[model samples]
Target chain A: MEFQEAWPYVVGVYMSIWAVLLIYVIVLQNKLAAVKRELGSLSKAVERKG
Target chain B: MKKSSLILASAGALLLMAGVYLAFFVAPDTVVRIDDRELVQFSQKIFYFHVPVAETSFVFLVLGGLFGAMFLGTRKRSYEQMSYAAVEVGFIFVLLVMITGVLWTRAAWNVWWEWEPRLTTFLVLTLMYSGYFVLRSSVQEESAKARFGAIFSIIAAVNVPLTFVAGRLDSLKPVHPKVFTLQGASMEGPMLAAFLVSMFGMLLFATSLYIMRLDLLRAREDIEYLKEELEVG
Candidate 1:
């Protein structure tokens, strides 16, 4: 196959890896932040009740 | 994030970048000769990342099954959480492998997909794992959910080796290239170096993701327990 014909697949494979990693990391960060916030509130609730 | 996980992620990212550089700039292009004509296959570059991701997915799925079995034997909440996290991370890598594999297939085989043994078995593995999440959601009782999930995970893990060997079995007639066999890898020094670096990086990155997901699962469980305690108090 011609070099030009095959280069797009190489680029696509690399781009897919990068894209998936970026999206996964972002999702994890958001979930972590949300969990931390919930935990903080729960801790305060316990302290206030005690 | 945990310090260890962060360190692993950073190191993995760096190695992956280095692998990319080596793949493009250092490793020689793969050339195939047919009828006295040499063809340079630029698409073979995808092999470095595609195989690594596929192998890494296998590792995570196997770990998930091991953890699931441990959870069943000991009834440990931590093991259950670890199994769930590993499966989730494994699912992500499996999806990546499918995507990259399709692209490579298009480039190399001039087709989007084929029904060869390796690809067919891998597709089955992916679908089975996808059902894992659906099964997890469908069950109502917590204990039952965990029980069923663990059982399914173990069953699914058995397919991993089957998929790996499908390409190598003579009767299967798989078009998938077998780079590592009983003999050894078929590539040269620089190509091997690139593959090793990428493989390690992919494994570490998946590990980091697994750790993060495990922490999240535990946090959610803790919150549930705390909420129950508060309600009782």
Candidate 2:
């Protein structure tokens, strides 16, 4: 196949990959909520232990 | 811009140009079997960029393991965040490798996937690394999560090279079936130049991404710290 004909495959792959990345980033942001809550509670414990 | 970003961006551009030039011009075009009957020409050209960068993904996987081990040894949370960022990048690159591999397989083998040894190893590696993130998220304690994440990262990383070696071993079954031996890898002048450019460019790109993600994670940690400080004050 010629380069022009196969170029679509590359583009499609790129697009799909980016979509997955976007979903991951969103999930990461959601995950930060858990991190923040842990930090809130854990720092208090660290302070008390010290 | 940060120093690392500046260096990486410039290097990535130069490398990208060189790799592209070499792949399109210097390397010889390949004719691969598209199907039992049909053959695909020029489709094999993707190897120059696809294979080397695919190989480079291992760098991040190992880095993730090292940082995880460091965190466990020192009980430092910085190491956990660092490991997390690296694994995130590693996951992205692995996905890219799978996509490129699938494309190559379709064009070369007329199939999307097979349970071949190397490919299966990669699939397992991907799952193992994903488990690292999942394990981290499941626990609630900050230090425990950090410690657990670090340990998991090390274990997950150890799997990557073993997977690679196992895959290579499986490919040596010449007695059962004949396989294409890519014996001649001679690169013409232009093809070599293009390959160098692309590989270097990708390296830069991956580096830039690593730095950016690390910074983001650090900043998030800082904000959490500040909030805790305010509550105490």
Candidate with top lDDT is 1
lDDT of 1 by residue, B14-105 (tens): 99999999999999998999999999999999999999999999998999999999999999978888888999999999999999999999
Give the alpha carbon lDDT tens digit for every residue of B1-233 in model 2. Answer: 35786588678756665666666656666555555754446665666656655655788888888998888788777887888888888878888788877886665556788777677777888888878779888999988888887888888888778766655464543111112235643655666556656666766777776776776687677766766665666
Q: Model 1 segments beyond 4 Å from truth?
A: none
Candidate 1 docking: what grade?
medium
- Give the per-residue lDDT of model 2 (tens digit) for A1-50: 65655656544544554465446545654555565666667666656655
Q: Which of the numbered candidates is closest to the native, going by highest TM-score?
A: 1
True contacts kept of each: 0.65, 0.13
Candidate 1 residue lDDT tens string, A1-50: 65889888898999999899879988997898799789889988977888
CAPRI band for model 2: incorrect
Provide C-alpha RMSD values for all models, in order.
0.9, 6.2
TM-score of each: 0.98, 0.75
| DockQ comparisons of all candidates to the true complex | 0.78, 0.15
Best by DockQ: 1
Q: Name the TM-score of candidate 1.
A: 0.98
